[model samples]
Target: MEKVNYKGADLLAHRFEIRVIRHFNNAIEYNAVPFILTEIQKRSDDFFQFPLSNGLLGTTIVDSAVTVTINKNIAYEPRRYFTCAHELCHVLLDTEYIRSHPGIDTEDKNGLPSSKNSSRERRANHFAALVLLPDTILNALMMEKKSKSYIRHQQKVSYETLKYRISDFIQLRFLLSRSMALDIASAFADKDADPLQQKGIYGFWHAAEDENISPLSRQQIAQKNNDLALGLIDPMVFEGCK
Candidate 1:
């Protein structure tokens, strides 16, 4: 939650964003996650990792790859997605500036970067947020479906879902539904009903319970993402992060 040095982070974010844009040339409509990895591969093999531990929280490595374990036996989709993207930020944006830079403690059994001076891990996290929530796409989608119903809406969305995409994500599912939006509306319609589960939209929004903003959490992740670049972190990252 510290104030992020966005000005510096924006410089790096913009630089890399342009790199991705140039690589895509005119095909810039694809997902940024895969695209960033593609570009990283051209220069190195550090974006992807394997042998992830079952209870893994997070890790930042010298190369681009960061290994985070969600669950080996079951699927925890949201956390997995978040971790990979966070690690991606570390790989792409963190830079080493000699005297002014953080040093790697390779001899310390692989914590190369000492997590000080300039925190590469933090930078990567910022990059991950930008990649996952690219402004151009998220804003347009939210604005487009600003009036659609969440529950009644049944359609295949490439990046988001009718299930709990950002709309239901923030509890506006009723206003955005095509028909079945009332499935959960009645649950809350009683006026006595708890606002905990607004249809199936409950899970995603509370995916990170340690810190909740009801509606702003949706937008805050992106904003804090920029904040992390400035050396700040959303509570989730700061809460239990090493």
Candidate 2:
């Protein structure tokens, strides 16, 4: 099965990126999501080590100047950074293609760039995987885990016998809660549903935080999301979702 683009919504996946970059704090750090995003954009040429452009997947034509907006509502900070990177892909790679292949996800043909169901969407997704988990950085991260796993084993990020402790430096600088900061963890662990389906659950969970819900009750949301997806979700593209 294919992963939902989330229109670049899930921020949790970028936890590793945030955690790693924080180690070099004087190099990059931010109190808010937007600042971090802009800093990231500035450092993209250095970190992602990729050339930038406003290309799309033929059908969808998004925009050239991609704006990375930090969602302050989510409880997780890394999730915010992940979202910025995901949108960065669309801005950097999906603008033109979206215009040409516009089809699904179009509320109207008015002015918005259209997309061909999930083609343009899926391609940007592939782009995100390449963006977030580029081979070099991933290897370095894996090594921190003391991972003895070979290339073939690299795919098993979650189950690997190694464990790389989240650096204390990152937690202090980023102001990340330990539970919120660990692992390039996925915000939603739902197995029954795709990322798109689980986004609402994430959004709602964040919303509930501002409400009067008890801490114990909040714990149920994650478990519930997993339960909802357990029978329905199917893994795709990557393993351990990292």
Candidate 3:
């Protein structure tokens, strides 16, 4: 991974995300995804539904109504949750900026700011990840049950499909890519376990053949997330995310 030093602004943005999560009481105490979404909406004065292009995920209009809208094109639950949370960040942190630029659509087509100067979008994405999957919550969940046991109870798929399913679960739960999730699984799974039976902990999934993590794979994961990624509040928020 390229070693891009995190500038002071980036660190401050990260700290801001941490504070936002705290303001919402960590968003995980309710132990329900729907509850988080409900809380977010309750904070808003009004919400709208709009059909947005595939590339564009959402928009927020902060006027007298404090309105927010997300693209209807995002069909999946995980992406929908992330997009909503992203806009909520704007509602919570960027209200002044939005109010000044009323009726202006922050056209973030790729989940980042439209321009290099738009640092708020970066911070919003970071805030969304924290709201959706706080490290503290995941760690506490893991402490209550063995990883393998949880997997076995949560799924009934054949051993052949379990590995991929686990990968999906990790990606959805932690807001990570498949490659990053696999790398995490490779580190968390027990090497001694049978390939088909291995299972991972909170932030990882069981590894299948050729899915093992090596130094090169680790670098790839970091690069995919951007070597200096800000999709997290705490640097150690998710193990193996770096």
- How accurate locally, in lDDT, is each candidate? 0.37, 0.35, 0.50
Give all TM-scores, in the order shown: 0.40, 0.32, 0.49
Across 26-112, the per-residue lDDT of candidate 1 in tens digits comes to 322424555544545553344444444533434444433332222232244433454555444544444222223323211111212
Indicate the worst ten consecutive residues by lDDT in candidate 2: 158-167
Ranking by lDDT: 3, 1, 2
Estimate candidate 1's alpha-carbon lDDT, on a 0 to 1 scale: 0.37
Cα RMSD (Å) per model?
Answer: 14.6, 17.7, 12.0
Q: Could you say which candidate leads in TM-score?
A: 3
Estimate, for each residue in 152-196, the C-alpha lDDT of model 2 and write its tens digit. 133222221112222221233223345443322232331233454
Give the residue spans of candidate 3 off by over 4 A: 1-32, 102-109, 115-117, 144-242
lDDT, candidate 1, residue 154?
15
Per-residue lDDT tens digits for candidate 3, residues 1-242, read 11222343345434544654554543333222454457568878877668866477777777677778887776655566667767777776667777876643454555655534356666666556554444444444344434443433332212222343334445654446777666444443434443222222332221111134433465465454432223222334344521
lDDT of 2 at 233: 35
